[model samples]
Target: MIYIVIPVFNRKEYTKECLESLRAQTNQGFSVVIVDDGSTDGTEAMLRDEFPEVVVLKGDGGLFWTAGVNMGIRYALEQGAELIMTMNNDVVVDSDMIAQMYRWHREKPQALLGALELDASNKKPIFGGERLNWKLNTIEHLLHVLPDAERKGLHPVTHLPGRGLLIPRVVFDRIGLLDQKRFPHYIADYDYTHTARRAGFELFVNYDAKILTYPEESGERQIRSSKTFKNYYKHLFDIKGGGNLRDFTRFTLKNCPPPYVPYHLANGYARRLFGYFLK
Candidate 1:
């Protein structure tokens, strides 16, 4: 059976909506495993009272996205799930999303799957298959250039965002869980896709399976809002502030070519500095 794993931290309303959407899905052969990361907003209590069918796991507020997801993934594996779909709790999925992803997986049994994510407010495509340029250390998203009709077909991706990622049991068994310690927040998705690619697993995005999610704020916003050097430093280094130099360095060293590592690191620093000044 397919197991849906969601890692939630607060945002009770969004969580409720996400669960409701999942409950209304066309495919019923799935179970939900929610890892609540110490939400004090009555999320756990509400889930127990309203959504008793869900299997809830509690965390000590320390299990960030990666750890929380890892917890749910481990539990799903123990429960004999053939496929595990990890999604953010802030998104509303389409009714046939699971079925479509499962159908694609059945066709490409050895592939890792993802769905097109659209902006919840504007209904515009936000995240889909991305092309990574190792030489330039840049990523190009296909959402803007690819038309709607072309997006209906499966497309290969170098990296996928973790919002609506689907992984077969075999992929996890071969690659293991995401690197929680190294990438507690960001880059973990990129690392996972890279690891899977190294293991000869193809990554594909099924555009027909879609979800609506909020867009993340850009780094320039954070830089512009930093009023002091202290806050600037925090925004530059803190994981939650969308900055973690160590993790970024680790990802570059691990995945990037030896010669390109320094170039990428320099370029990243230069870009962020330029963004700070431009902001």
Candidate 2:
């Protein structure tokens, strides 16, 4: 069976919409496991009352994203799930998503599958996957590279974002759970997918399956959104902040070769410094 794992903190409305979309999927062969991490906003009660069929796992609010997702993934694996699909609560998937993903997985069972992300409002592609530009010392999302007409089928990628990603059971048996200790929040998905790619798994973005996402709610909010020291500090160190130096450093050190690590780090900080002033 294919099991869908979702980790949520609060935002009951978004979770409800996500669950509703999942329920309406064309393929009803999958089960859902939601790791509700200490949502004080009546999320647990609402789940019990509304989505009684879904397996609910409670957390102490500290599980964060990586640990919370890992908790559900463990349970899914224990239950003999053939595939595990990871997604965020802020996304409303298309009705044919599961069917599309299943077809893609069947065609390329050895691959790590990713679904295209579309902006909820604009319906334009978003962060589907990442490609490392070794020359520029930067990581760029494929959404910016491929146009709609060109996204015909699967394309090679280094990291697939967890928001609507299909991971085969063998990945868990090989790479183990996501690195919650090193990346409790942002960058964990990229790290895990990149590690999987390194471990002989091909990464691909299945253009057929897609999710409508709320981009504004992304943990990827840049520090340049504001010009304050606290924002800068969070941008560099906060667990929820994307491209934080600590987690990004861990990811690069673990993936990038030694000689390229210093260049990547230096270029990253330089861009942040320039971005802060220019913003």
Candidate 3:
């Protein structure tokens, strides 16, 4: 059976809505675990009273999504889950998502997991996975863009996103659970994909599976100061380089562009570069 794990922090209303969608899934042989990462907004009480059917794992009051995911992963493993599905608490899934993903995995027998294409507020194809721009050392994917029909293979993907990802138990066996200390938040998805590729497992994006995502505002000016932007790339650099700023520098500009890059990121890159040269 599959184990669906959601990591929530202070998004009570959205989390409740996400769970309700899961409850309506056509494939029902799965257990739901919600990891409440030290929310203070009455999330715990609400879940207990309103959605008692979901298994709630209380965090140590400050564990973020990475930590929360680890908690749920461990629990799912203990419960003998063959496949583990990780998703954001703010998003909902298609009823056939898990079933289709499971069927795909069974057929491929080699793919580690499947990612569902997401529809953001624009109703356009958002993130799934993409070919890494290795020359720039950054993970790049299209937003609001559809895949080319001439693309090489079936269900092709070079990376996976955080919105909707399914991981088989074998992937964990190969790479171990996600590193919580190294990646407290964003880019953990990319780190995991890179590691999985190194371990020789293929990842796929199932276009047939789609979910709705509350789109975040994007622009070059916003990147520098935006919490989401910082959390994503900063952790990515830390994990890939072991705290080396130069490696982080290569990644920041290599995969990201100015219109989409934040202003603060430019400054951060400058400071990091100076620090590197001075050292």
Candidate 4:
């Protein structure tokens, strides 16, 4: 069975809407797991009262996105689910989102990962997957154009937004769990896709299965960092830990050039200079 996993910290109304959408899925043979990350906003009680069929996993408030996702993914895998879908708590999926992804994978066993046409709450596309840059990092565009099937090999990387990523359990087994140390947010999706690529899997965005996403702002410091010292340091740390220095450095210099060049080059140099001191 396909299992859907949602990691919710505290967005009562959004979570409720998300679950409601799932409950109405045109494909209903799936189970759900919602990991409540120590929410004090009556989320616990609300979930118990509203979604009795959902498998609940509790997390400390500090668990953040990556940790909560890991918890839910592990649970889904252990439950003997053939496929596991991870979606944001604020997303309202289409009735056929899960079923379409299931069929895509079933037909294209080589396509190990998939995402949906994630539109905003107003029904505007928000997550159309990533555009590749062999030099630096992949760029994400929120549905710049109408939904159309992307040529399979056109992009070097296909990003599945955690908001509506459907991953087969076999892919998880091959790549292992999502890395929690990547700051619990931001880049984990990219990191996971790269890992899947390394493990002989293809990531794709299925235009057919679309979902609606609410633009929630408060919890994403990793993405909205204001180019501060700490943010730069964290960026360097991620490069060091998650990517090879030389390759990532070249990527930053060549693919991600100009305004972002000096900043990344400085960080790359600093990372190399301080390599001895970093743990």
Locate the minimum summed-lDDT window of 10 residues in model 2. Answer: 218-227
Q: Residue-wise lDDT of candidate 2 within 137-246, one digit each (tens)? A: 76777777877688857888878788888999999999999999998988889889989987999999998898999877765454556668888777667776664777
Q: Could you tell me how far off, in angstroms, the CA of residue 244 lies in candidate 1 after the best superposition?
A: 2.3
- Candidate 1 backbone collisions, by pair: none
Instruction: Report lDDT (CA) for all predictions.
Output: 0.84, 0.86, 0.68, 0.68
Model 1, 151-226: lDDT tens per residue? 8858998878788888889989998999998999777888988889878999988998999886653433554575
Candidate 2 whole-model C-alpha lDDT, 0 to 1:
0.86
Clash count per candidate? 0, 0, 5, 1
For candidate 3, write residues 115-205 as lDDT tens digits: 5555555665556557765434344554325546632123666777656677888888788887676566655666677678768988877
Candidate number that wins on lDDT, 2 or 4: 2
Q: RMSD in Å for candidate 3, one decimal?
A: 7.4
The lDDT, on a scale of 0 to 1, for candidate 4 is: 0.68
Evaluate model 3: give its lDDT: 0.68
The superposed Cα distance between candidate 4 and the true structure at residue 267, in angstroms, equals 9.9
Worst 10 residues of 1 by lDDT: 215-224
Name the weakest run of 10 consecutive residues (lDDT summed) in model 4. 150-159
